[model samples]
Target: MGKCIICGKPVDGLICEFHEEDVVFEFEGTSPSQLTPGRYYRGTVDGYADFGVFVDVGDHVTGLLHRSELDRRLESLDWEPGDTVYVQVLDVRDNGNVDLGWSIRQADREFRGSLIDAPDGEYRPGERDAEDESSSADDDSTTADAGPSTNGGDATPDEPAEPAEPAATPTMEIEEPDAPLKRTTVDALDDQVGSIVRLEGEITGVRQTGGPTVFELRDETGTVECAAFEEAGVRAYPSVEVEDVVALEGEVERRYGDLQVETETLEVLADDERETVATRLEEAIEQQARPETVEPLADDEAVAALENELVDAATTIRKAVVEARPVVVRHSATADGYVAGAAIERAVLPLVRDQHTRDDAEYHYFERRPLEGTVYDMDAATGDVTSMLEARDRHGEQLPLVVLVDAGSTVESTDGYDLLEVYDVDRLVIDDSHADEAVVDAVSVAVNPTLAEANGGAVTSTALAANVAAHVNEAVRDDLEHLPAVSYWEEPPAAYVDLATEAGYDETAVTEQREAVALEAYYQSYKDKRELVADLLFGDERDLAAHVSEQFRDKLEAELETARENLETTSIDGVTVATLDTAAFTHRFDFPSANLLLDELHRRERDDGPFVTLGLGEDELHVRTTTPVDVRELGETVADAVPDAGVRVVGGRDGHVEFLVGERDSVREAALDALAETLA
Candidate 1:
């Protein structure tokens, strides 16, 4: 019988059945049948195949470590042929096939102790020599009892031999005290793997996984994950949370090619030590977050006019990343909005990856959400509050910095911005619309050309965002050169068109990309679709854009044909007014939404003369005009004409109004009359 290494209890082998999984085993047998299932073993990388890798267990046995069993991507594995690795033997088939699974620990010392699995039995490495010596001692005792004594005296059976002197009990020697543990920084942990280290830093994030509690620790140099476990699926150090200064001792380990710290002891720092770490982190973040300069992508006076505001906005975003705060971007569900949001996404993702140590920091630190319209209403604000609160309670995350791009600039968004203010969440707005003066005080930073007395009507939100994105990270400036042109449905400015042309995107390509993004935005309007959008705009896959654009063209043409066939035209006060009952003519729940179809139909019918297109839905009215129209003012006019109709504008700059379904005819007639007087 052997003893369990952990509990010190005698068992059938080196470990009890309950603790078998804790010990690692070495295979000494020559055949696959000698492998024990559900136990970890040391193996060598024999070779790799498309589906899995082949690991050699012993001299004559091999195991297949399938890709499905890997916790990470198979291609991410750095193991080469003949390199040592650790894997669990999941099964040994009747036909001599060995199946292996992934093991979290790769080092031998990570296990309690190793036992050799020989052809005959399992034993520790030096147990055989100890057993032989024990047998020899027993034989010597037997010989001495049966033969005459060494003193040369005959002893009778009744006579007892002289008692042997009791062997002296061994005394433990006291050694000198151990040296104090040296402090190591996160950046230097790579060179100290498999060794104990002490670190002092501030905890930026804390997450609970199935078996461990992972705390994201950030020092002056970088960030790293430190895992502590109290038990299976239980929280460790429940008092620790984000933004707390801590001193930790752990073994530096490599898990799935990423450096991790297996925490042994973690303590919160107080007084001077805590202040020291916090001050160091704050100083580093401040110095790294501020951009040295703010430069526009193109030579545009409109963009250059807002250079100071752009620098402030860029500084806020950069500082959020360095401070480990999430950036939540909210944009309108339109072509321009998507382009604006994607440009910022492209710039911020690289900064997130560079500032954090985890591979998934980009996803955690940056998020993009599409708003239904140009207004950030209370519904969106409520949803954002709920999600942010949940994240804070569950993961100990700090409140995110909400960024409004191409949206949330008018008075309609004031209530939403007010709700966010109650939580003290930071907000930044980058828009080109006629922003309400009150909005300037609601957000942290407002970057709008109207506030600077620039030509806001001619500037698209994409232009401002692309310029700000360039300032955020100058390295991605070339990647955003063509974005401004994609936001314009009509003829873009010559400066932007020339910029896109110089960036290898012709007019046709820009149009196709714009159409494609608009079509995708209508579906899953709330989702960001970060990867798909990135591929369509920045990836090398040109065919993907063409394919999606073709679908967009087909859908729009179909909707436009139906809309034109049912169109009604009238001239009031020398202004042409075209109307369509979109509820009866267009597909309500599919592609080519009422707004998009109306825009296309009006584009086809409008000439140099003043034209207005009204797409009447069940309870809403969408207006598209050749002349600038204030839907809010139009709503007030209609409300006066039809007092019972609940006339209110939903989308501010996009020109959307809502009324009672029963008063649709009254609202339509009143809206046309109001448009005629305004346009005349």
Candidate 2:
């Protein structure tokens, strides 16, 4: 019975995930190539899930090797998790999750072994040496854990090592045991139960369930379920990311015949060495990154360009937990042909939620809401649906594919997803070689940019929020004085109103205007916005025409682009214009009700240059842009246009709008900067 020479856990119960693989033999079509289903092939276990191990048997295809199919001796195999091992595909679900199975009992003479076998004899004959006792004693601590931090068991435990460089600080701290601390590595918690030990890794699950907050903790050693009793001093859990290394302070709590560590404290780990470099690099990169080229953006591209900026400008809460805002949602998956008996392209699931809201709801006023969705592929790219590992070989990248996903987000019992867009997928994975960022730079060949490209080379808001949360964690850990430094603060908009009138106009207005109906205009704008979003974020050609009619699609496309471009930056003196252009042509553009006359004067500074226009005129309001930047007189001047309508002029010392309108205006004007105090 072979065991994981490190953790001493039964391979049968342990899971394997496919991160690296080699295409031993080329398949026929560049498309779905079929081979004997039952054949055994060598590959690497990327990682594990509750369902099974994903084995990368080359061919850019991975197989799901389920735990049930593996023999009891699976507990003893010394194969490196990412290092290659023989695997047999059991089943590949349609939902993109894969399962694999391995058993020494079922394997040929090459793999046959007993669980009692140690790492020295079967797995690596060369690793065993007479003088290797020192290496064994020091390295055994790592055996209990195998993950991104593992480097072929070569870690020198006797020395305090220097941290390397990643774009972010990747260090995590481990709170030592209170007493005779079990110096066992995380992987070692697997077998022969003893006093629970402490290990640190990323927190994958932070779900409050079964009367306590339970989470899945992972490190190079392996993954284990962790539960908090509320007494562990963890008031609230941090939204740690999947790839991020977090410091987990807890003890082993075995339950249901399974061992899962229970955690109390979770602290952000800042690998100080890399923090300086990553922080500098991050700032440099942002300074260098430019918005996607625009100018001829069609209807969809129009809004997307703007939306892209909003996504970029949005306040990112590093390692923050925010839902995805899917203005236009679609579904797709990565599991195609390898293990599945047939190709299931037709099968699709709801990939995301629609970013819309009901009228008058508190959350309704907000354009972007929280998003909740599942990731079909862990290594999927930004613009493409294929996995990054797969993209590496196909595109011949200089670096191994690295996808940043908040894969660690968890809600209740639902599995969390990562909003990853491969801005830079580095290096090629050739026969499992050590590829780094430098190698990828050498290959520096560019492929079509993914979601980042489609959305003007920016990540989605969902991604931004997650990154922000991560940034927060890092800032705290790295003690980044520049970050977490508040430049401004205030309350949110309280007396805000929608731009369009909620009357839901009819088509009769279209006949009178000789143009498409306002409803058609709005719908077309919506469709175009969604389509542009699809193109920008997913690189999918989801068009606005799909949701709108041809009659208005051509007409409203340009306006939609304008509105999208001004996203996030549309705030005029802190008053967000919202989607005014789109609402102009929609069925119901909720009336701002904020004293229309004042708004007219507010917009006077628009394009007319030096006109001091005033009063609400025929089908339009007059604006006076050349007026002095004085507040009281502007309010009084604007008050004249209202007749009986309330006029309100806002802003501070610089100036404000003066018009005639309702109490909504004057009162709102007084409360001007109050609403935008926060981001102002």
CA lDDT, candidate 1, residue 583: 90
**lDDT tens string, model 2, 1-680?**
54443345555321111211211112221111333244345555543422345455553455656545766433344443355566654444443333455644233345422221121222333334644987787687776565333344456666544555557766999988657344344457756354556555544334332133445554433345666665322324545443344556666644433465666566566778336433543454343222233221112231243343322322221001111111111111100000010000000001111111111111111111011211223332232333222223321111222212211111210111222323332211110011122222332221111312443322222222222222223222111111111100111011100100122211221121112222222232312232232222223232332332344334334433443353222354433422222223322333212122233323533443322322232122322233333444445543553445455432222223333333434433333333333223
Cα lDDT of model 1 by residue, 587-677, tens digit:
8999987887887888889978999988899999999899999888889889999999988876565558899999999999998889999
Q: Give lDDT per model, in order.
A: 0.86, 0.31
Task: Please state the error at residue 443 of candidate 1 in Å.
Answer: 1.5
lDDT, model 2: 0.31
Error of 2 at 614 (Å): 7.5
Give candidate 2's TM-score.
Answer: 0.25
Q: Assess the local accuracy of residue 27 in candidate 2 as a C-alpha lDDT between 0 and 100.
A: 21
TM-score for each predicted model, relative to the true structure: 0.76, 0.25
